[model samples]
Target: MATEKLRQANTGIRSFWWWLQCIVSLLLTALLVMDRAEWIDVPGLQRLEWQAYDWRVRSTLDGQSDSSLAIIDIDERSLFEIGQWPWPRTTVAALIESLFTTYDADLLGVDIVFAEPEASHWQRHWENLVEEYPSLASLPPPTDGDQVLANTLSNYPVVLGYYFQSSVQAGDPPVIGQLPEQAHLTTDSLLSLPEPQRYTANLAILQNGALSAGFFDNPLVDADGVFRRVPMLQRWQGELYPGLPLAMLLALLGQPQIDPVIGEGSGVDQLEALDVGGFQIPVDADGSALVPWYGPRGHFEYISAADILEGRIEPGSLKGKILILGASAPGLMDLRSTPVGAVYPGPEINLGLLAGMLHQSFKAQPPWIQGFDLVNLCALGLIIVVIFPRLNAPLLMAVSGTLLLAAVGGNVWAWHQGWVLPVAGLVVLLLAQTLWHLSMNLLRETQQKRWVAEWFGQYVPPQLVKSMVESGESFGLEGEERELTVLFSDVRDFTAFSELLSPSELTRVMNRLLTPLTGAIHQHKGTIDKYMGDAVMAFWGAPLRDMKHADHAIEASFEMLAALERINREFVAEGKPTLAMGVGLNSGPMSVGNMGSGFRMAYTVMGDNVNLGSRLEGLTKVYGVSLIVSEATAKQAPDWCYRRLDQVRVKGRRAPLWILEPLGRWSTLSQERCTWHAAFETALDHYQAANFESAAQAFKELGEEDLTTQIYLARSEYFLKTPPPQNWDGVWMHTDK
Candidate 1:
């Protein structure tokens, strides 16, 4: 990781990432936005939120059974003891009578609906016998069991349960039996709440006899079929009716009317909660409330119907407890999927809500919940735009984890305060943001590593390239001008030298010459531009900036001379002729960077100074010297002693430039050579001033082996013979490259 070049969203890439994040964030956020507006369905996100809520609900469960509520479950035991179900009305009446009169419970509810009158087959047989023989007609028609059950229900106002259907089936009655009292809330007033289309209710006698009735069916289950919420009231025929829990609660509180607490809006559109007997039963906009689960399902007291009939229950167990009669047997009772688990008893759902209402523990998901989701989404979007791009992968994960913990913590706290605010959308947004940042960072670094490998793989050493990559700065690949030193070198008389060896031998010779020379350049931080046969071209000052390009280039040139002497010794031992080469170096402003066609690219330097360096190399063979340099290179590297060379113009350019010959460092050169070089320069000055006699006499006395002294002596004698020019610059121009 330390070696990786992690690119931040710099100016060149910032706008691209901005729009990319916007597009991705918008696509994810739009689904929730449209869902909140009721214009689309985002079931996946909704399911995620539902599951999160379920986890919270489970984590806070009390895990203790409530003694205040009990169910008279018509389980298999009751079936075995009582003959069969659709139990005789006389027996049902006896059970009801026993619960209230004998056990003395505070309130009771029957989850079973008595939609039809009793069959009384035995009574019909008896009446038929009496009509046929006139023997049993006077037996008082078989005691009325339906009327008996009615009397029991009338004697004590027990809340009865019924159900509504969203769709009516074929051949089934659209409306059966008699419904309980309606709240008379018109459709115009509560348009958000559901309106019932059909119902299966209790008989007229039973309805008139009981305390009241309420619908038990929950139609607003989540898309995943979890019973997370149930409505408190639903609309029907321009009227609102209470749910079973509400009906039971109202009956327990002395039949108080349901006073809905609506907010500042039309049609009770902002339905917050239902006010019943001074209890604030909080609900959502659609008149629904999140189910307040006490614990896992079946966390309540249960007494068997057979036990009630056979008098097996403890006497005080049902004395003050509210009882609801329903079946718990698998095939007989209605089952529901809830947060706790699948296959939950339907009566338990009602009992859960009823208990919540009794304790006022119900939580409201009011109209503003949609607004809260929108706020979370918008907030995360801003974070994506402002903060995400700047963070690396690890930090993105950290931030996402922290936000999830905070959101879940805050949401659970809200739940405890009787409000349900969602954090699922927040989780989705965070995931999107974190993923975008991490993925993009990976891609950017991947491309950058490849780029470094392609451009500098051959020119720079591995460690140096690694350091450059780790610096994280942008490397401009386009050609740019920079001060650099260029070196050009080749074997003297290369054509004649190669003729002395076979092709294979020449290959080995060139390798011997170029290999160590290449090392010398790399050692002094120079770039090897290209090699042409026996000739080599190299430079310094890029793809990295070096303040000492001139110094380093001159140092490399000296190393090359030393390397050639070693090669010559190897040739002498192998019984071959010794060889020598000249190096030319020039430092000045030059174009240095990546340059090439589409097929290939190379890091190199090129300019007029680069060409001048090549010309100086050729001058070395003509002037009896092994090293030559331009004045610019000599000025920048002042520690080396140099001999003055004549000014001359190269073929390509009109400007005449001074060239110098590097002798040795000041610390290494002897006193005798320095004196002789100084004496020769004095004589050359007299010749350039047109004093030919003095310059010729000085050259004759010196008689040095240096080619420049001899060339000047011949030049001085010729100028004396033709000394008629009124103006002469003494600057020489060469026509050769």
Candidate 2:
């Protein structure tokens, strides 16, 4: 019996490893569920999602601007030539007249707010002159510039700009301009939304003259300061004001009525989209829409305000096009961060939004998308949990990489089709799962190798054990039939040797002898089965498969003899008793595996062939040989030299079996040994034929000191004197084991 304890030790480690995998899978699943339920919103994950979103927006842009929109920039040159900002209202009136009458622009929207009327220097001068003269007050106040600008606004289709303020002050700015009658709608399912408390609007003079007005407040600037979306409409004091871009689109669409799509559940209401005429503009639950960037900054054609005022602009440049008036001079501070550029002109953002609306290219992320993300997250996590453990390393990597591509690729395609899908969470989960599995499997295999080495390394060769471990084969230790070679060895006079020494000394002797014997077996790639007192049992083609099992077994037997000789020299030097051993080798089919009761187990071999090997070791003492091999082993190792012993039926069997004494290798044997072998074979043939006198004469000629020859001679003489039976097959029957 070998060390069966090794088999029992592995059960606990394997169980623990399996449990570890389950724990990791459960943790990942929990994380996925938490994120899906919106119970945990990871800031880093959201930030990275926005970053990926920015990249998708940039890469998916059509890079083509709408030709129907134009920007009238009061640029640096306009500031230099037309005298700084807050120019005389007459100059502003002239620019508006050029856009409407001269260029015939279809619709115009201002990104600037006339919150406070310009304090005209001429008015100051006229007031001082009148105060000094006291008689020029009847001169009509030199034509108020505010009235001139207000008159110009009244005659044209211009949308004025205003801003909503969340901060409250002691005074309230006048509410300017009329909002469309259908701008704000409240449904039965909706709740009251928070509205701004304060406003910065135009003077009553400008408000009365303007056709309509909108809030220029972009409430969707992210914490990172990127302008990604604009609120389509905002509430102030229960009144709705459209954003400048939406207001311009409404004017261009002939002031179509606004309608809010409401969805209700659990007494909570949300707006899904806004319907205008036949076009449906989708929005978030908060009524914000994702900006569809056409390209980089400066996408819209800009005509200088000074160029329009001086009539130096090209004719028909603004004709039949929507015009957005804003400032681009660095001093004006109207630049903002956007997906397309970090320092984008604010007016260009409005123009891009308006263009996106006209082309119906806005991206929407409504409430249903959250359900879509949750479904995808759970599905992807399930795939990882189920398939990761079942696949090999290369195949697992391939599956992970394919999933990553599908997640990202599908998200990009959805973005191109105007559907905003959450990609960051799915992509991160795929990558994290792959890395987690990889690291855990590596750690598991490392521990498994250490376990295998601790149990079997002493019995099996290192190279063979390493091969088994790396192959990743499972070894379920139930009994199995396999062709194997078994070896059994015992000290020739072990009982006498033990009787001469104390118990401790006998153990020392056994340790010294068994150490080199074990080394020899392992060197030949055989497994040392176990040691019983002074006897050692070993086998090959077990615990691992060895095609050269028979050859290795024979080689190990020869080495055992050599090791014994070396051991004898040391014992002689120490004035200790010398030792001799007999080894028997047999090759056949046997059952090899972990076998025993619940409390004990043994990874060993058992069969009729194994018993025959033990019987052969006992017969070695009768033949005076150190090594004996059954015919099965001898036939497999043709390159080794052997002397045929005899055909004998042992105590257990009815059929007789041939045995042989293993000599040195065939290539190393001398011609003298070959001649002797031939002569001994002839004598054995004659004896089996019942020629007693001839066989005895031939045995005496060979060697009187040869124990095998003497045994055969004695057998021949005894059989001749007894008178042979009719069915004598020349097979000796041994009565003792």
Please provide TM-scores, in order, for all candidate models, with all chains considered together: 0.65, 0.69
lDDT for model 1 comes to 0.80
Among all windows of 10 consecutive residues in model 1, the one with the lowest summed lDDT is 1-10
What lDDT tens digits, residue by residue, belong to model 2 across residues 127-168? 899999988977677767778889999999898787776556
| lDDT comparing candidate 2 with the true structure | 0.81
TM-score, model 2 to reference? 0.69
**Residue 108 in candidate 2 has what lDDT?**
88
lDDT of 1 by residue, 568-640 (tens): 9999999888887988988899997667665566677888989999999988887777888999999998998
lDDT to native, each model = 0.80, 0.81
lDDT score at residue 597, model 1, on the 0-100 scale: 64
- Residue pairs with clashing backbones, model 1: 189-267
Clashing pairs in 2: none
Task: After superposing candidate 1 on the true structure, give the runs of residues whose Cα lies further than 4 Å from its correct spot.
Answer: 1-25, 119-125, 129-134, 183-191, 264-269, 389-392, 432-440, 460-472, 478-737
